[model samples]
Target: MSNEQVISSVKDSYLVEKRRNQMIKGAIVLFKEKGFHRTTTREIAKESGFSIGTLYEYIRTKEDVLFLVCDAIYDQVRNRLESATDWDNPSVAKLEEIVASYFRLMDDMQEEIIIMYQEVKSLKQESREYVIKKERDMVAMLERMFTACLPETIDEQDVSLLANNIFVQGQMWGFRRWMLQKQFTLEEYIERQIHFLKQSLSTDHMQNEKTDQTP
Candidate 1:
């Protein structure tokens, strides 16, 4: 194809993907505003301004819709963390950026994040696994970044535990926005957390990790 034709094709693909995302985002808003138990496929279709028939083109059930919403969230966090972590940057700065990206994501998509955090259990076993596995993948990705940042003295076990704690604690801030908002703005809250997070991944912990690894 000619360059102009290729460009046109790419643009068309982009618009299609954008519309599909809008449908999903619309559904997330409805799911958050009305709890998942009270929500129906028709409501999601109407909220998305797509016919119920067309909505089915993307998902077969309410569970499917929930999975898609959480998937979008996980995919975004995965991409953000991948983009934020630059090996060349100082470890502390990279850590701050990673945490900052997370809070900014929460601030911008509070409803979506809150919904997934609260409603993932509403899904069936398989659906829940799909979401939870993606969550784990994201944690592993961050842990890799943390590994690069940590001193060689830090052992695998401590780093693993710390990675889990940091991710869970960050999620809590988003899940409890009603209370956390009363305490601070999204940026202020994240900065304070990052400060403590940096201190927590201390040289002493690395030494402990090293000791644990002693053969």
Candidate 2:
């Protein structure tokens, strides 16, 4: 089930989606300005252009809003990444495109990403676990892509690690932008990363080729 479906008190699916979209848009603006702890449910209601009573109809507490925001951010990132690559015909080039697309998406949502990292700690235990599971699912998506594109010798464990590294590398741009932005443009950063990734994967590919010939 979607985050909206899980938390929203609104019984109608269409209404749940509609109201949550408004709430998310408003909550993001407030969360960016005041951080999660300082942002109040009434404020979120006001920001969302809904009455406090109407807002309550959709969510029970401020924590629900935070959960919704975090879930939406992750979903947006995952959806864009999916569109950026063709799983039916995965290739190294497609992998490169996915990385570049993810970095750009992170850059666009840096403030929200920062908010997610900082305020997710305040969520209830179950909500936090749900968010973590979503992240793992994303890493698994990357792992599948790597498995299709990489040579057989790379091994599942290596692909898994590489997939995680690529995901983290994209997030690092958002989390460490103050330092990275000063040093390199987005294109430069992507180019350097692609070079490093290819170097690592190609080394494994070549070693495997040599071993196969030697026997």
Candidate 3:
């Protein structure tokens, strides 16, 4: 499901990974500026410090580069989330820490996140589906963490909604920063969001408890 599956004329695995990483870095900049359709493979090659011929050796088409970039970005986000989170001991405080970490990551990778959203449609259907599946996997990770920390009385559907909301809220900081950043600093935003999530969870747990107590 990664760009490793992309056809490469190069036989050396290390060189293939190295050059593809270079391609991903260069392509993200161009994609952010020109979009996927407007950017040319030659431009990607030049930006990546490879000739067109050398670039073709590693990728069959420009779509391949886009897929690589998307895959790399998702891998980075997931790896960072894994590192920041403590799955062994789930708690509300740990969930808040994970959400803050995710928002901070979104802020740091705003350009890459924007490019992924803007250019994802240009990818082939299979590649696009793969990218979407990766996204769902991350959301599912949050859902698992939420399930572990939330009260048992909370409905499954509400837990899923909470998990999805947390995921999108992190993304909103990147895609909607023009408005959000004008209104709040990053620390202020994280504090307000974490507060909102806690309030919602507490209210839901209280309601569920009341339902159980009803004769």
Candidate 4:
């Protein structure tokens, strides 16, 4: 569902978007600190620099706030990825650039990512599904990028799986920061991951070509 379908009583499009952004920013802090189930709507309103009455003007329930937060975070990630990517030129080097950019973004958004993972289960079923679908869309974006760069001999299934692997590897830096950060700096992590991905892609393509020759 679109942000417009979030059931706001406010009619001004710009105002609705502005207020919701404020609400999302504040709600993320509270959700991270107290978690979604424990964070009260009144607290969210106050943190957002508004009153309970005004919060209700923009949302019917706290779940609406959560949905807005999740949607906003996803939008930010997707936009950053799209901007970093050069869609017109899909090459292995370009793919590596995208991977590094994505890993850096994941580092930048660590807290927000943690909040989403922790609180998304609190979202209503429909809202949860919508948020999940947004994630799938992101994976699909990576799949398209991989398909463009990888050899045709690579199975379609492997390309899809590789895309998912890249997506999760980016998030793993966030989710596993406690341990990973102890070992490698963010730059190191991104470099190593890019190296590994490039090697895997090259190895797979070579193996596929070798198999074709054998037959």
Clashes of each: 0, 0, 0, 0
Residues 13-71, model 2: lDDT tens digits: 88888988899989999998998988899999899998999999988889888888889
Model 1 ranges off by over 4 Å = 1-16, 88-90, 203-215
- lDDT for model 1, please: 0.73
Model 2 regions lying over 4 Å from their true place: 1-5
Best by lDDT: 3
lDDT of 1 by residue, 1-215 (tens): 11111122234555545545766778787877888889888898888887888766555577766766777888787777878888786475777788788668667777788888789998888768767888888788777877888776666777777778777767777678779889897778888888787787675676677779999
Off by over 4 Å in 3: none
Q: What is the TM-score of each candidate against the true structure?
A: 0.82, 0.93, 0.95, 0.96
- C-alpha lDDT score of every prediction, in listed order: 0.73, 0.87, 0.89, 0.88
Compared with the true structure, what per-residue lDDT tens digits does model 3 show for residues 162-193?
A: 98998899889989999999999999999999
Please identify which of the two predictions, 3 or 4, would achieve the higher TM-score against the true structure: 4
Ranking by lDDT: 3, 4, 2, 1
Rank by TM-score (best first): 4, 3, 2, 1
Which candidate would rank higher by lDDT, 3 or 4?
A: 3
Q: Residue 193 in candidate 2 has what lDDT?
A: 90
| 1 versus 4: better TM-score goes to | 4
Candidates 1 and 4, the one with greater lDDT: 4
Top-TM-score structure, candidate number: 4
* lDDT at position 24, candidate 2: 90
